[model samples]
Target: MQALLHKIIEQPELHAYWLNTLSMMENVGAKKIKKCEHPIFVNEVILKHASEEARHAFYLKKQIQKIRKDACPTYEWQYLLAPKSSYAYLNQLDIDVCRYLKSKHELKHERLKYAAYLLVTYAIEVRADELYPIYQDVLRAYKSPVSVRNIIAEEQNHLEEMEKQLKAFSSEWEEMCRVVREIESKLHSVWIENLHQELGLS
Candidate 1:
């Protein structure tokens, strides 16, 4: 799976799309945090998440805008902000008790690996957050620097803040990693089976 992710990353446009999708996912994650009533600790996490997510959206939008503006100098930013369906899915997940239960069960079988997977995921998100300048360098390589720097700045802030927040939740890291590995293996097999079934490959 990591190899697959690396393959996806090698294609610049696909890499951009993958980050865009992840930003959308983080946007949903922020929304999930907002609805929590657990404790002060949870509230702090939620607040930080909301802030990070808004920045993620801003960064992704700016990336798209840079391309659109370069291609069409007269393009309105609003035109570039077209609605995306992933937001609906994010809203549906809502980081609630049900989702927590699902994640818990997903890890119950092999806790430590689950923790490791999540940590890796968080690390990837942070790295993605820091890759704005890299994206700018990309645009520059293409001789197009239409992206707003401010958006990237905010994303940097989000990366730092989110990393700090994620660290606070690391107490159960070992347990989660153990579970995550087992769960992911099961999920991988199931997912492959389902795809095969749908494609009549079985």
Candidate 2:
């Protein structure tokens, strides 16, 4: 990822597209939260999480202007780098986590959904915390104008919130996290390999 970051930031168009891709992925996350919202029991944390994620998406999209105006005009597949694996990364993780939760806990309906959300969001937040920092380091080293510091701060808080929620949700929360991370690690590798191939670095 660090190497990819180093190479990607040198090209304005690719960098802009990368930021747009990140924005699209963030928007997808926020969309999932809304889709999973309870009809009558939506909570404050859920609302805050969704809103912050949407803002992160918007913030990233706005950053593209610094690289080049109109670089990636839309969040279409053709405008994104490694579109297939990028989209699959989160989708596949959610499926796998839900399956794991259902089988292990015999969770159904809302219980199943909330458990999966907690695990999936925790895994993704962990990644965001790690990824944004490395990307920020790359940006600074290259003296690039783009910055993800704001996103990084929010992701840190998100991770902490997810951790506390997970503990309150299950006594076996650590075990659940271990399984989800395994699933996420494989998906992330595929995502990164796809990007490397697109960048001709694989």
Give one digit per residue, the lDDT tens place, for model 2 in 73-160. Answer: 8888988999988888889989999889888889999988888888899999989988999999999999888999999999999999
Best by TM-score: 2
Q: Which ten residues in a row have the lowest lDDT in candidate 1?
A: 74-83
lDDT of 1: 0.45
lDDT of 1 at 89: 32
lDDT of 1 at 152: 65
State in Å the error of residue 114, model 2.
0.7
User: How do the predictions measure up, each by TM-score?
Assistant: 0.42, 0.98
Residue 51 Cα positional deviation in candidate 2, in Å, after optimal superposition: 0.3
Candidate 1 lDDT over 27-73, as tens digits, reads: 55554444442444344544655676667665654564443433222
